[model samples]
Target: TVIRNAWAGDPYPIDTLMMYMSNMAWNSSMNTVETIAMLTDKDEAGAYKIPFIIYSDAYYSETVPFADLVLPDTTYLERHDCISLLDRPISHADGAADAIRHPVVQPDRDVRPFQSVLIELGARLGLPCFVNEDGSATYRDYADYIVNHQRTPGIGPLAGWRGKDGGSIGKGDVNPDQLQRYIDNGGFWHHDFSDDQRYYKMGNRAYLDFAVEMGFIPCAEPIVFQLYSEPIQRFRLAARGHGKVQPPDAERGRIEAYMD
Candidate 1:
């Protein structure tokens, strides 16, 4: 959808396309030839159809050539990373868990961590969340943000060893030494579900309650499975010209064909 949006200029034309670690020109693309064509294709004015592109990658992959700016990134062994609970968590059917990656060795080159670069970029752009009330940068780096930035009052990227003294789990106050706590615990944290919360998760009362406590769900209501999705139907209806926002003529056919 991102490629399609940039290629067609649907809704509106974009000024810049920023990508991180995505190899759309080759490995990640379903049709590499078509993807490359779309990436390099120019408009009538000789401007690229997708306009400017900024890409960050640890290695010089095939997609780097298409980018207008290439921000070199640090390798995994030289950067801090989190397999966060708020993002793609490492969870199983019986329990939920999260992990982190701490740099074992410092980089010998001049490359910086992509996450830290992005954080600096966010601050430079004066994003509301990245700036303080006095208009100063709120976080010094990615590690600073990880420890103090709360998505909600008590919830953050990690789900374990929370609170001021690092005794709480699931939800609590921000812990300044969260990264150290993760490091001390073998770079990971796991929460085991009780017997009642182990199976039939969607409709299980105990599981639902636990999910709410962990800020995974809004409430403790059983999640009802839907065979038919209304959002998908809405898009299909829009393809038939039944909405305030409709797809372009070139895209209507594709939407109708695949929306089902």
Candidate 2:
């Protein structure tokens, strides 16, 4: 969608493209030659279709040469990262788990961690939640943000050893030494489900309660599977010009053919 939008400029044109660790010009793309051509494509006025690009990567990959500006990044051994539960967690069928990666060796180069750079950039841009009440930077670095930033009242990126004294789990106040605690406990946290809660989880009362407690769900309601989707019906209606936000005439046939 981004590539198409960049070239077509339909709906609106984007000013800049920022990418991190994504090698779109090479192995990541289905057609690398075509992708490279698109990235370097020019308009009739001799202007680039995609104006500016900023890319960051630890290694000088194939995509780096196409970027207008490149930010050097530290490798895994010299960076901190979180395999957060709030994102893509490392989970088993019977358990929920998360992990972290702390720098084992310092970088010999002048490169910085991509995440830390993003945090500083967010602060400098004065984005909401990245700034304090007085408009100062909220976090000193990515580590500080990871340990303190809460998505909700108690839920954070990690889910273990929470609270002031680091005795709580699933949900609690922020623990200042949470990273150290994770380091001490082998860099990962796991929570096992009871036998009853492990099976038939969608409707299991125990599982539902556990999910709510773990901030995985808003309430302990049984998850009812939908046999018919009204949202799809609405899109079909839009395709038939029955709504304000109707699909373009070019897309109407495709929508009607596939939506049902």
Best by lDDT: 2
Looking at model 2, how many pairs of residues clash? 0
Best-fitting candidate, scored by TM-score: 2
Model 2 per-residue lDDT tens digits across residues 1-260:
46656766765788788888777788787888788888899999999998998899988999999999999998888887999999999999999999999999999988988888888899999998999999899988888888999999999989999999998888999999999999998999988899989998999999999999999999999998877888888899999889889887878999988888
Candidate 2: list runs displaced more than 4 Å: 248-260
After TM-score superposition, what is the CA distance of residue 258 in candidate 1 from its true location, in Å?
A: 3.6
Across residues 1-260, which tens digit of lDDT does each residue of candidate 1 receive?
A: 47767888877899898888777778888888888899999999998899899998999999899999999998888888889988899988889899999899999988888889988889899997999888888888877888878898899988888999999888999998889999999999998999999989999999999899889998998787879978888888999999898988888988987888
Task: Enumerate residue pairs that collide in model 1.
Answer: none
Residue 154 alpha-carbon offset, candidate 1, angstroms: 1.0
| Candidate 2 least-lDDT 10 residues | 1-10
- Note the Cα lDDT for every prediction shown: 0.88, 0.89
